[model samples]
Target: MTDSDTGHSPVWARSKRRRSSGGGGGAFFGFLVFLLALFGAVVIGMSIKERSVAGGGAAIDGWIATGKASVMQAIGKAPAAADVAVEKAGDAAAATGDAVQAEAAQTADALKKQ
Candidate 1:
């Protein structure tokens, strides 16, 4: 009897048949996402390891202090200019105080004389 009459297809005939389509692209994208997650975990773990080796919290503190110092230097006034400003403010305040006191004394004397 022939292979088709025996109810079994021949291997060559099966090989010649077209295969059904599958969700191959979805599976490939899922694998890529898994690899990316694995890579991210490894990178985070290595960063933690490096931070631990490089003084951990102290390193972070030092970085913060350095950043603060850099900002202060960038925004801070020069010492000489700051001193001059302070002196000018103090002199202006003193002069204002003296003028107010003199005005008050003159007002009091005028009231007493009247």
Candidate 2:
């Protein structure tokens, strides 16, 4: 293709001109990059400030309270098996004591016979 077909500037010639222009576009691009970086920093800082002011801290506290309430509610609704378990535990202890007493009585009888 001809140079005129390619926007009236030869590819190599445009490259030469760009190099001769002391990098103006490069400087402008660098300035744009700096501006964007500053804008991003400002946005992040504002976001942090907004969250601190707009109940983000309260939101976390509320979540913790809600979680605690749910746990308590779950515990409240658990099956009532404690009474039966305690009765069985008492019966087991009594049986264990009786077995020990019986063994002691047999030992005492043997000593008396001797």
Candidate 3:
């Protein structure tokens, strides 16, 4: 706690110097923010189309349209994807049950033969 002799740096200055894991969290958050901004632009794209709003560059408009379409398509496919996932899970469970039953039957047969 004494810093007079060596005049070491203060605790506050040295504290939390280690770099925490970046984990690309910044990139992910940036992408999310960009997505949200583009979605906002899509909402206002109507105004742009009708010239009620300005700053409607083709690239920005394209980004808005693409984001909107991707989102809507994903939303439309989600239910069907869930249904397929459920069906696959059921199939896997049935297969696992059959395998367990077959193993038990084999074990019983082996014990009887012995």
lDDT of the candidates, in the order given: 0.78, 0.79, 0.82
lDDT of 2 by residue, 13-44 (tens): 88998787975887888899999998667556
Q: After superposition on all CA atoms, how large is the RMSD of candidate 2?
A: 21.0
**Candidate 2 vs 3: which has more lDDT:** 3
Runs of candidate 2 exceeding 4 Å displacement: 1-52, 74-85
- Give candidate 3 regions above 4 Å deviation: 1-3, 6-59
lDDT of 3 at 5: 72
Question: Pick by TM-score: which candidate is best?
Answer: 3
Location of the lowest summed lDDT over 10 successive residues in candidate 2: 52-61
C-alpha-based local distance difference test score of model 1: 0.78
What's each prediction's clash count?
0, 0, 0
Clashing pairs in 2: none
Clashing pairs in 3: none
What is the C-alpha local distance difference test score of candidate 3?
Answer: 0.82
Per-model TM values vs. the true structure? 0.34, 0.37, 0.51
